[model samples]
Target: MKLLALVALTMCAFAANSVLNRIGVALQGMDPLDFATIRTGAGAAMLWALVGLRTAPRPVILSPKRIAGAAALATYMIGFSWAYLTLDAGLGALILFGVLQIVVFGWAVFEKGAIPLLRWCGAGVALIGLCVLLWPTGQASIPLGGATAMTVAGIAWAAYTLLGRSEADPLGATASNFLLCLPLVGAVMLWSGAGPMPFAGVLTACVAGAITSGLGYAMWYRALPSLPTTVAGIAQLSVPVIAVAAGVALLGEPLTARLIIAGGLVLGGIAISLAARR
Candidate 1:
């Protein structure tokens, strides 16, 4: 129970990254792609320093499968960072997680062979809740391009997650993916001419990538084996709510009635789904 609680706290750190990115780009006058590139670069460097060189596990040779996983991670990181330039953190998370859940659920069906009807029904309810949460009021127009970018990011993340599950060592695989992906991300930043990275933005990206995100993943998998599928599923519902509250508190983003109600509905639906499973 304590370990699961700790994992949930670390996951909240992952959730905070969305808000942190918003602070770096939307508020701090930094280019989104540049921010993303620096984030990956810093995270890679940190992993190399912290775990890559000193690990006792036989250094896993990079394979085609691993490279493919890195590619997906790079795409996800870049697209996610870019999306925050125009989208609210909470809204962005809703879209990202919504798509991610669907993609991952599909992957389970196709790759894992079968999924319980209860899991499918839970997914459907979560999907409907996400739609309700994201259903725009007539006040502001949605940025289709930004939304598309986030959806692509979600797809990439699903791929990353699936790849991890197939690996011999999930944490080692994640570290390798992060280290290998920096160069790819760097090349994209150079090709796109994303220049003049802000000091504050770079720092925020680095902290988010290296510390919170890196440790978050380690803690998540550490707890996953101990947690029931239903408990794990419900625990994830805390992510978007954390993102929304973090956005409001850290980014000074407004918490509108629509946002509050919609977030509540999403969280509530997940709660109900978990309860049903129990």
Candidate 2:
């Protein structure tokens, strides 16, 4: 029960980061790139601070591989923020997660793991649900730029997860990845002309980065060894649902019937997919 609760909490933290980004960028008028840069920079600093305080010897080593892995982290941070600037939180999450699942499943297959038929079926159902969730209604034109950015973010995160699978110490690896990526993030933000950030934006970005992204991701790594690839995929499906609720409750975003129905299908399909793994 405790493990399950922890997993749920971890997912909620992940979901809340999205909500925070949406609130800051969409509602608060903070530049998305600025948010990403500050969030990652603060997160990297906080993680290293904790590492310094802890006397444990580092369990992960940096190499060329680690540098490559850091690129994915950079992509996720930058792409996600850029995407959310024009996309709804729920829609952005749906796209990001849909790609993530497909990538992970493909990686599992390449590793010679058994691919269950039920899991594929679940994927199909979930895909359909995602289509419905993303399908624009009544002349609501999709933001092509935002959609592309979100897709890139999804692919980046998928790569990040797969990279973690190979690391002996995922938490240390993640921290190191963030540390390495921060400078790159800053450069991009500066190149994009992101100016001085507002105090409110800074606070929100730091909280999202340090607490939700940093610690939440570290905790996710702690739980990963106990979870199968399929289960991990399914567990992540909850993030979009949680974000939807947060959007409605905190951001005053309207909850439409379509979102409710589509979300149900998406989450239900993910549950079925994961359950079939056993």
Candidate 3:
């Protein structure tokens, strides 16, 4: 029950990030690059502080895992922010989680010999759901640039998740990844010359980084040990649903039939994939 609660909290936190990002960038006119920069910086600071309190300070070891994790983290942050500029919060969340499922499932099949037939069918169903969601409809259409960026973000996040699976010290590793990614994020900020940021947007980013992302991710890592891989994948399916509900209530985003159908299929398919017995 405790683990379930923790997992629920983590899922809420993850969903909250989508809400905050959409509010900050889309509603508040905050520059996506600036929001990304602040988010990464604040997350690093918060994680480092937590790590310091947990144990005596020590030099960070620059291992290959840390480096790759940092790069993937940076990619996810940048792409996520940029994509939100044009994508609706709910739609973006769906694409992000859908692609994430595919990446993780694909990795499993590659690393292991073969996936169970049930999972394959589930994957096929999920792919069909994605097609239905993305099919060009006269009523509304997703922006190409936004969809592409979110897809990349999903892939990067999957890589980050895979790399962190075996981590013994979740907090320390997460802190180190955030810290290492700073330089890369900074260079992009400089190169892009991000415009002025609103104070409200900055505050929103801070909360997202420190509370939702930093603490939320730490909790997730702690819970990971107790969860099976299939269970973990299925659990994240809740995030998009939560985000969509929040987006509608808070951001006044439209709740369309297409979104409803696609979401049902996507989440249902992923659930089927993970729940099926070998």
For residues 163-182, could you state the per-residue lDDT of candidate 3 as single tens digits? 87777888888888889987
Best by TM-score: 2
Error of 1 at 63 (Å): 1.5
Which residue pairs of candidate 1 clash?
A: none
TM-score of every model versus the real structure: 0.84, 0.90, 0.86
- Predicted candidate 2 versus true structure: per-residue lDDT over 2-79, tens digit per residue: 667778889999999998898778777899889998889877877777777877787454688678777998999999
Ranking by TM-score: 2, 3, 1
Give the clashing residue pairs of candidate 2, or none: none
The residue-by-residue lDDT of candidate 1 on 1-278, one tens digit each, is 59647866866887877777887888777888888877787766666565656656744649897798789989998899889877876578877877777676665556565455655566566656556655566788768888999999988976765555534565666677777888888888888887667788888888878876666655565565554443454456557767777767776768777667766666666656555555
Residue 101 error, candidate 3, Å: 1.2
Q: After superposition, how far is residue 20 of candidate 2 from its true place, in Å?
A: 0.7
* Model 2 steric clash total: 0
Models ranked on lDDT: 3, 2, 1
lDDT of 1 at 10: 67
